[model samples]
Target: MLFKQRTEELNMKLNALAQSFIGFSFIAALTACSSSGFERTNLNQANQRYHAILLQQEPVTLNSSIPEGAVTGASFGLFTEIDGDSEDMISGMLAGALVGSVISAVTDGSNQATRYRFYNQKKGEFSVVSKQKFDKNVQCVEVHHTNKIKLYAVDSEFCRLTREDNSVKAIYGGKLQRIGTNAWHPATVIVKDELIIAVNPTSQEIPAGAQLIDGRGTWLIPGLVDGHVHLSQSGSAFTRPDMIGATHIHSYGDDQSWLIDQLPSLLEDYVSLGITTIADLGGPTKSLHVRNQLNCESHCPSIISAGELISATPVPALNGAQGPTFLNTETSAEAIAAVKMQRQFGAKISKFVFTSEAGLSPSQLDKLFSPAINEAKSLGQIIAVHAQDLDYAKAAIRAGADILVHGVMTAPVDDEFIELAKTLNVTYMPTLTAYEHYLDIFKRQLTFSEFERQFGDHYIIDSFAQLNENLSATDQMFQLFTRYVPFVDSSEKERSSLTPQEQSIVAQLETLFSERILQIQVANLFTVANAGVRLGFGTDAGNPATLHAYSVAEEINAWQHAGLDNLKILHALTEGNAIAYQIEKKQGSIAPGKSATFNLLTQDPLQNTNTLLAPALVIANGNIIDLQENK
Candidate 1:
């Protein structure tokens, strides 16, 4: 008789709770704190009980500290309150729905008689106010329930409440911290949503309910950025076998088909190497389509591109490729139209290829150069000029080019050129590693440093290993350009006259290789960088053996070997590159209002730049990428 009376009482209370929800409106639950006050307490015993009930285990014993009034039964108790904002109530509702769903699934209505009470205080008395199932709210908040376990909660199924993540995430206990302005301190990088909200010193307490990433003894630094790259081509000889020696100098064939197919793998390769952003200097007009196709806040690195490269008619290197294949223009009007068209195609920057064997006439140069510079400037866009030689570089500078995509590789850079570049505020991309690609391929051997071995893409390394094993310098197909052949001497008369043995001997001569030229270029780069000239981080990745992910580390190590300070090298890789790319406003730093993109290193990169070769964790736009999983 007593059990029947209790059952009737429980049904009456539940009915009242359900009725309280009707016509009250969700607006009434907008902010639970809107009520007069709250006496928040953390009840460990209540949390224990809640988990036990959800796990379908026997209810845990409650501590005496739990108020007798709050514990109606062994399975029912109030948990210790964790501090939260207005979203806490929503979190509570989501969590309640989570528990209720599990209970409903396991019990199959046998436990339907069980009563779960929710309370809110008014007039100093806790009362059963309402009960409602969690559902999508009209205010852009959706609760997605998944049966799979999550990183945050491994033992329990996750019910992800997708609202703007307003809670702070604290990365604490780092022995070393690197933030914007090159400040290194023992600080926690606090992130909320997509932005880095703060970098508080270790002295501060981690915010309640904030997501915690235990840095422990690791080093925290801003994610690295590769200032220049080309997504249109894969960084392999298979994609561009002609790179070995462009003897034919015909169109680069149809890369669009393969480019569209391999875009995901290319982007993943870069992001896995801790590269947060890549500036695609030049590509086909359809480059914009590729950019649009993959652009998103996901695992991929951010891609900014110059949709197409504008070049003068009769570009010596391209042979006779024209139209969208090479965006050729001979008049100022055509140049303007080309720039505008590229912009229309969603180009973030303007790229002009200034290539000439004898240099263009003054008037001809002005017609091709002036309009592109003027149009890009008027549109507030920076121009990346591909200048292969000092003369062409000078022409680009005169045209007010903002960035020189390559150093003066044909000859040594002089003080006059350096001063001119500095005065014009031109950023130089030495692309030192780009030369090594040709050197390594010609030598019929591929090598990597210990750091590269660890961090480099296994796919690229394995591919090179296979190439090295299958091919040798004696192969007839490789002999076309292996005999120290000069690229510009269109007449192959010199190579044709050489006997087979003589050609083999010429190919064996190490001095015949242009690797020495690259060394001189690196010396010039060091001089220019030390002289206060701006140098951006670019390895001309996508060039033959300058493999995307591996080359970034190799490039940094190259600079380090050239005696650049680690901090300055880091600055160039991060902020300086961002500035050169004109994206510093949104990226390049661990500062408030900047994207929460950074790398957690197992070791301090400041001590050894190669420590960045493989990041322990790469956080891009608030998403943590598992480097190992991707590898």
Candidate 2:
């Protein structure tokens, strides 16, 4: 009898529970229909409340610190529009429940009420009100009497909102809240909509159709900067395929027609390799044309052109020969005249060649450098010199050259030269890779087999070989000079007369001479850079066996061989180069508001120096150029 009674009681309780659920469902449906009829008035009232809140709260200054509590209150005040224009009691009750639901969804504990001080406009004073924290996680607060709604949000946290139609919504901190899976929410909440319902704590499932991104495990870093390059010179006549070590290919005689014809394709190639910028040491006229072309295109690397070279009025003859057209002006006046000519052609910097071939007397040399310097100063441009020997370098410095284009090779640079360069603040573009390339070819008979494999074999054997052969007699003379140096002293005469075994020693001496020359060159470059002198990297491309954009990696490698830290190498490519070009303020760093120019490498270059050669994602002028498509 007792067991039967217990069973009957349980059945009765189940029936009552089912009946209660049915009644609640019917009431919810009726509420939805009633709310739909009043949607327009409710929305208008919400907008009015939002406008009132905005008028009450002044715009906050960005980047300024605000008290956390004050920020919370301000954010909540911004949500006043959620309460529709229903009966005051009904609106207040509904808005309170919504806020409560949100706080509950996001927070851990039960609901609690707290007192808040608000500015009462009508009374022109502060008033105390009781606000219950409906849900901690949702940040819901209930306004006791007023039919008003408000929501508060932190700057970076993610939040979910519910719409009037009982649909869920997701929103980022700034703008564009995501639409929830349920379409019941009004379409108005798609983007830029003010209606947001604080999600309930139990709602852990993502709203239908919400997109999520995993930002918790990743970080964003600034890109890499490539300081110097010549896009037009990469695959040109002087470049050979086998020269794997050549990084920069400086083109000497680039013209408008040639650049116009070649830059489009060349730029496409560079963009694919993540070269974001190039400092054109020569070929300004054509460079301008190329820059214009790139600007016309939707995306391309930046080109900083240095106009034409500002050599003496008559340029020096190569190897003291009269084979090609040379500019050799007699007086300093002629040099200044040449600078004026280049300036008129829109050159940004003056480039002059200080060489022994011009054979300018000391006084004339002084005059030549003076006028170029003065003109450059007047125009606010830098004067860079293609100085090869010590005499030319000293002369260029004495005349106030802003940059020394090549490392001194003919003679060792002394303390005095370094001091003068420091005093004058002259920058050095030590095309060390170029020197190394020449050294390898002359001493080791290294050929461009590797380079040819990438660039092509036909250019190497046909055009490149012909060019090298043209210089064969000059090379022979240099070889003969080395052979005769050993025979100068009688003490060395016996050594020269030695048989095959002694002859091997002579060959070793020749190798030593070549190595010593390169060491001397590196020493001078280091002296200048170490003595507080600025340095830039360039590949003297357009010469035989030089690589193009890829030469930058080799330059970094060479610097490491010379004992520079990886950071210093990076500085050379970034801040160092920016300073050399006088544009450090705008493009060198990843700081805010700076040009968004950077490289996306697979690894950190500072950690593993070889990472410099790794493929990267290149961004220039705020756009991601299609490297894969171009490749």
Candidate 3:
């Protein structure tokens, strides 16, 4: 009887909602119909007037130049009636539609014609400007807004937009040098759109009325590529605290909204460091969205991503529910589905997790890797396995994984392991700096440079500083430690004043996996590089103590410390990484018919890798970025 009464009341509420929705729909439809008719007439009239004026005046050709100090404005306008114009009308139409939707509906809908109104200095009044407006005396410009966009009409090419360059640019009179080799020669690199058209460009004239940049005494090399990074992971100090097994103070995971908002600035930071491409090893679906977003922009590194992680059941590294980036699969079908999902999300690499502690067993590993590898191969995605221990490394290599994302930290790489890697043609991505970062965190020696302090996450820096001052604080780092290791203490004051037994345990812990582990890892890296096993460069920069932009150089220095050749390091940073990532045809080299992604250096990086520490200018996809302001 009670259920019947509740159902009746719910039905009545739903019926009321339905009636309201029907009335709203009717009003919307009627209003749209009335406004469309009025909008179409006005749009037609605007188009006719705009075209008639253009037809009367002989189209004047204007130079693309701006006065020293001029105020520029961009609103919305439609094209004139002249047909066959190839300018983009989408910007104008979208701007007009946005304005119309907000302000009024009486504006035109038929003719999407837009125009620019220029403030002519000599005339002392605003004059209508067309594609042919040739007045050089104009100091200011404004765009006129209308309802209809003249989709087929010619847009005014004479309007001077602020910070907008719509032509192929050139940098000649510079010594172009190929990376990893000591070959420097006088050559001109021609760029069209985002690709390099020619090297030692034989063209008699620049195409698209190119802008010239004087590269008189500079050396050019392919832009750097970091093989492993995580875009979604905040490499800031505060964010890394959660990784240390600490009490929750900082948020562990960022929502999609936060990821999207911070992506632009993060990409710029990578580009500012002369990085043109980076492979994201693992992250949530939000990472994929951010990757696609950056691929569309002019000033960002080309992002290749894993999209999601395939891990053992329980996901020892991170929880899927809390961190939505990893897919823990206990069955072969589940593993295949995870790989398929990653492929669907446009992942160029498939990342599998192999941890020694509570990770997949041998049989479970077989079930997971066999199907995951098959799916990844079918999708043409490179397989990267994160294996931190020797056993896991052997298992990944045996499973035909294309890349080992990290070196074996607990043990040295022996002859057998090197031979197996060589036989399988597997690339070794030695994240040497990552281990060093762990040591830095354990020792409380983490410090930031001025640049990091200026641009890094302030919350992270402050929190880490607090941790350094008071290791016993129940902060994010403390939470991380306690969550992972139950034996660890959560009490701030008690942890600070450790008992004698606890102090002894801590001392033993320090020796167990501290500096000695890093030394062994570096030794393994040296052995692999020397034995001719393919060595790839990666810093694991998104981890704690490893920063994104700055860590590229740090990784190089670590390689240098490991006694790797400078030329080999450069190759790994560029051409080698491109081959590993399968983007050699499009990027990784500054050859003709490649991407115009290279760094303009004041000194030759072949002489000293440190030369890349400060690049004069960084070019990516034909866009020359001035790093002086950012520096």
Candidate 4:
């Protein structure tokens, strides 16, 4: 009977609580339909009151020593006293609802929750407010509930809220709660605009509505640098609509009237292949003309042209021979005139031929070439000479040649020559591929079948016939006259009476002669590279069957085959080349505040040398050139 009477009395008090305010029962019914139910209204009111305290006329300074009554007043919106004790319950509920709603609104909208403590003067103890968001649009603003509103103070962002039945709800909101040293409990985090953040599987929490990018399961490394390549060649290759095997032929000298006519296509081809820069050895003045054309086009690679060849003398028999003749010059004045003529033609480096076996005296050769080297220095141009024999090589170096185009073949490089080259900082470009090609021809071996496959049947027939004719002429004429038999008038007449079968045998023997030249060239190259000479890469482009630019990789592979360290080979391709060309400041290296040029590899090249051949991204001047689509 006593329990039933107490229940009736509590019911009457609850009815009185609901009847005290207008629309109070309607608000309670709406709350019951929501997820938070009755707690929604109370939480909303609590948020409003919290904002009111935060937006007070004066800033509320919080510290460790605050009274609990003042905190309760601030949290429960009890700024003014009520008329009666029964009115206190009604006012407290309204204030708590208002504060809770305002707090929830602020925390939800901004996505940041903070823990704070305030002193309540009426309760004589500290009170804590913890903010937490339960959904995208809603936040739960919780207040520590106790017998007298406060007894213990909230130490951090974490707080325990107690209900009338003694059930506890641990509230952690506002700032993310740090659970331990360097460890934080996950909670809603707020991110502001214009802030940079790094995300990993750690204590740092991402705020609600924050943008994120997944970087998991991936590694970042430095980009690649392709030291030698032909960008104009690449550009041209890509521009063509029906480019199939045409690019291959274009890479060598095509039948086009002007090689410069192919510059646009070449540039596109280079960009497509991720060749951001190139060092063109020699072409017609047409190389310079093509360079000017590429200057106006987009996606062109950086090009460094050596202009045309500056030979020992203009010999119509040799390939790509042009410019003023350096032969027949006996005095320094004539040699200086030759240098001036080359400079006027805009040669970056003066190239000359020095061969003792070519029938020039040491004194005459010195007077003919040394002045040109001196004149080049006066004009601040580098000297690159093609010297075949040891005497010529030594003379070229002694004449201050900056680059030795061919390796020393007549004899092993002496220590004196090596030391002198190092002292003068002279570079060597050992055209090993050309030597290899010569070897292939002499031995009757096919070095590159891919080249033959790409050029159709008609081209193959023509090329083979041309090769046979050249071999026949060399065997019947030059070889016999130069080596086997002296070109006596009577002997020549007698040799002419030989049959076609005998001539064919002589043609076959001609193969052996070419092979010997190639063997000598390779031996010379091996000697030079092993002697620690400064070496750079060059494809000797426009030569028959030699792959342009792409030959750089092959050269490195050959060097590795000869037992050089991979890092040393890479350095040769990158830093060493830069030093060789004196362009180290503008190119090379993956560093900040430099030109944003780099080659992207599909895999780490450090692990495998073959990775250098992989096709991937090419970034130049801060833009990614699309090679896949162009190809």
Candidate 5:
């Protein structure tokens, strides 16, 4: 186990060194051909948020022409002397014309391009590869098109540059609605590079050559964030063998291979679904490898990951899962060592598994979690625990757990717990859909919404829809998993096309509300919300049936049913989660000097929660995402 920890730390170092080299080479290449220019453009673009100017432009050479070459050659061949060897002159002209034709044949092209150096007020200077030539001594508008920036010439007499700036994007005429606020107003948001320079400017404050985005009748808000997810799983029926024992149909090793290969696309899928950021609660060491890949990607969601789950007990349930699962630490010394290893591997949070099946005993909870919690605190890392059971959660909180990664279930929230949570400043994320999705996966019924069918990886979901294909495996899973939530009955079985043994798992399976623990989970959510507990939204994506991106709307429905208003839900999904995780400085809200990672919706998110799934525009780290392209 220590060897695995050492290997992960080594991997992080090698990854960083390699990435630095890659970054340097990329900047070098851009220097020769793209934005890294030879000299400063240094126009009136400094000390302002959204104004810039073009530094210089180099036009690509025009194509050589045979007719023009012939004319030039004829002129050279013609003699000024009168009546002297007209035939000689004709012969000379023919010979020169033939040579010119050969020369023109050697060099010809039509794809003319221009390399323009642009200086922004805040982001400094960069070069652009454009098809059209941008004029000098004038302001330009920068637009992202087809994964590249496009420049348009904008001229205005009313605008003047107080500081040197060449380019700016004034997204004009949109009703902006910020998270946690019901207020809306028509405003022009001026953006330079990736940050908002000005939300609304006076008429005289309009910068020269600012590109305008038609935000008319649109709702622009902060991009959504999924507070809890696991990149190690594939969000399919076979992703977890410890939970379902589906190894008979699909081995865990092969399933993980598919997921690792598909992880990059999954990152883009998150942004395409209007989620620009994600917090990976627990995964294997290779989750760091995925984060490395994410760092190199152009269009993807930002990730904050805990490299592996530091278990308080030896986990038999995770035996066949992806990567090494030998992270169980029992002693206080072992617990502190595990925290150090995760921190060395670049994990921002120290996450521990504290469930009943494979968690420390109630009496041993403080002894095991305390040392790790203390080490994490000393190392400036957050402590998150997977303690859904009420008593287990209380134990972790008392042990200085900063985040309860799941809702406190198995009991209702009382004044004692709420007061404790408030006093500890504990953040809670109620991953409402993962339980139901798991039930559906094991019970042999998955209701794929039209949105899920359209946006989700259909191949993965379709694998579960093969009726009678793996009924025995499904039954095996159902038998093993139903002990925790066994509300399925024969009445629902009579309506299905499946055999009696299968329990009709595919005919609009109803919510298992009769389950007492589930009732407690729902009741505890609204109780915490009204009690003013720090609440965040997460779907426990990568768990069985809780597909990434496609699962947000479903969880939104659950939040609504739990009596959380749409505004609160939106805030929880965005700024609330960021604030909980202490990452509001980098993301979570749309504000001046912050990263321009937000979404434009076709409908009001407050009025209709489902509309969050479909955004008209999504910007992640300043790169505009095309939703249809992902589809």
Candidate 6:
């Protein structure tokens, strides 16, 4: 159960709370400004819904200036019949129907003499409507409730009120894994709504009526942040036609529709895996629409997104009719316009696909990054570039990119590049398994973990088991669609009739990238890490066989094999993510003034890292839903 709290702590005269939509399971509660000792005294059968609490015999606050309760007000006044001109607070409080439902409902069905201690009143008093007036200045909603919530009278004094204390209980006795410092200390955390009120030592006294959630024997850590993902693809066999043109089998349109329709569930999958934030690097314009529609929702991860990429290599999927969902190469004014359009549609980062071009002079670099990077900076956005090879990555780094979306796998990242990365403060996201994922699917060697089988999208997971049977195509054809050097310059029509020379180059480029690539990627990852360049943990999920939530675990195993210590890996997932994604502050830390979003692991992560995948409880946006079903 989540405790809903009043926003203000100052003396507020009164506030009211109407019943919120029944979707969220919460009980109505009346709490004091500071002290908490209230306990549920009433309960009905189904779901243990508590209606009222007994506070008379509980520990009361020494101060009498604080109000005992408050009412909820809203932007909509339709229920109040208030004037349309300005937001009418009086309309909500006039009926007494506006507030006090949590403390006591009107037995008469509409109006009743409810008891409440208003604005430092000595005791609760029975009252009825004595006067009615309109006041636009009074900030009386729980949202707006504060010293500014002016004293109003629909009845005599000591009736309606807003209180703050004990609204949410202190989370006691968790070994708080302090981010930035590898120290775990016993701490008590208290939250009010979404903001953390305090992070006191375990020895500190909790407020009297404050409810307590036992967190002993658990490690409390900030929620994980996956810095790379894609919402356009669903990690299904049918999700990406551009990579493998199985249009005869892959219903590209229906798959896109399913992605939009099942977005809520997809987001929940991220949450279940303890990822509270994701950065969607690039996709079609519809990605912006998804970000616009679902941003800041309680259950969904906070998203950092960009529109279609400014591609150095023209995407073969750029045709509009094939549900064009990947990169698009636009230049000069058109490129700047595309960046502007992304910002307008909630794109916080500008993405570029900077593939290495043969014999391109140094002066030609501007054509790849161009005014897009400059324009993105002008609009306060950072640059994220997809550069796989060392030369291309260096070009991107020199172009002032803030993030490298993938580890350089074509060759080892050298010391000069490492130093350059450190100087630029560029974050490196080693999507260690994305290419391997495509190979797995193509070779019919794709497999899911038990955890993935339990929690991931079954349609996608099951499709992997039956990929070849569904496609009725050879591995070579699938490989041809997933481009190489020669394929990048040609159209699908040309691909159908490739010259023998071009085909030879494709085979050569494929071997160069495929064989020993993991070793190269891992060597680059740790070199950057050892040099103190920021490291971000990102599984390029939504790629074939790279299941979104499940891939995180897979990537973690890869990191372990790469010899990244547990502490470094944890930091990469959290604080390193903060640096890479350009978050304002430490969104990946557990401390005061931080977002009250974290996960509870059954054991200390430093000792038992497997626990990270199985969060015992997930508090996202300050509320815990049923994440157990995923496990």
Residue-level lDDT of model 4, residues 1-631, one tens digit each, is: 9998987677566555545642664787786766543543354343212110110011232332223333543544432223235477567756665666665554445433434333221221222443332232221223335321222223222211211111111111211213112222222111122111221232233332222211111111122333333222222211121211232323223433333454555555556555556665543443465465554244776666554455444433222222212233445676677567656656565556776534676556777778777888888776777776677777888888777765765456678878888888877766656456434433334344442344323332244344444444332333342332221212546657667765555555443344344456566556666777777655553344444434445565666655556555555555566666666664554333345455545443444665554436555655545665544
Q: Candidate 1 on 124-232: residue-level lDDT in tens? A: 1111111222222211111121332111111212212211234456666565544434445667778887888887776565555565565655777777888888665
Backbone atom clashes (below 3 Å) for every candidate: 5, 36, 24, 57, 14, 16
Off by over 4 Å in 5: 1-167, 201-204, 294-298, 316-322, 358-360, 466-468, 473-514
Segments in model 6 whose C-alpha atoms lie over 4 Å from true places: 1-167, 178-182, 295-298, 316-323, 357-363, 470-476, 479-513, 584-586, 629-631
Candidate 5, residue 439: lDDT:
58
TM values, all candidates: 0.65, 0.55, 0.66, 0.55, 0.68, 0.68
The residue-by-residue lDDT of candidate 2 on 42-71, one tens digit each, is 553433221010101122222312233344
Error of 2 at 577 (Å): 1.0
Off by over 4 Å in 2: 1-263, 283-299, 312-326, 361-364, 447-513, 613-615
Which window of ten consecutive residues has the lowest lDDT sum in model 6? 49-58
Q: Candidate 5: lDDT over CA atoms?
A: 0.71
lDDT of each: 0.63, 0.50, 0.65, 0.47, 0.71, 0.66
Once model 3 is optimally superposed onto the true structure by TM-score, how far is the C-alpha of residue 112 displaced, in angstroms? 64
The ten-residue window of minimal lDDT in model 4 covers 48-57
lDDT, model 6: 0.66
Over the stretch 1-631, how does candidate 6's per-residue lDDT look in tens digits? Answer: 1232332311121222322422122332222334365434423322221111111111222322112222332222333333222245445454333344433332223332222221221222112221122232222211112322222323211112322234465566788876556678888888767767899986565555454555666899888998899877778887766666666665667777777777777887788878888988777765577555774333778788877777645655433432344445545677787788878878888887776543344336556456778889999987998888788788888887899987898788888899899898898998988877765555455677787787777788776555566555524556553435445334668666877777776666665445467678888887888888889899989887888777898898888888888999999988789877766364778777788788889988877678897888888767764675543
Question: How do the residues 229-284 of candidate 3 rate in per-residue lDDT, one tens digit apiece?
Answer: 97766564444433564333344444233445666776777887788888999877
Once fitted onto the true fold, the runs of candidate 3 whose alpha carbons sit more than 4 angstroms away are 1-168, 178-180, 201-210, 237-242, 253-260, 294-298, 313-323, 359-364, 449-451, 454-457, 469-512, 626-631
Global fold similarity of model 1 (TM-score): 0.65
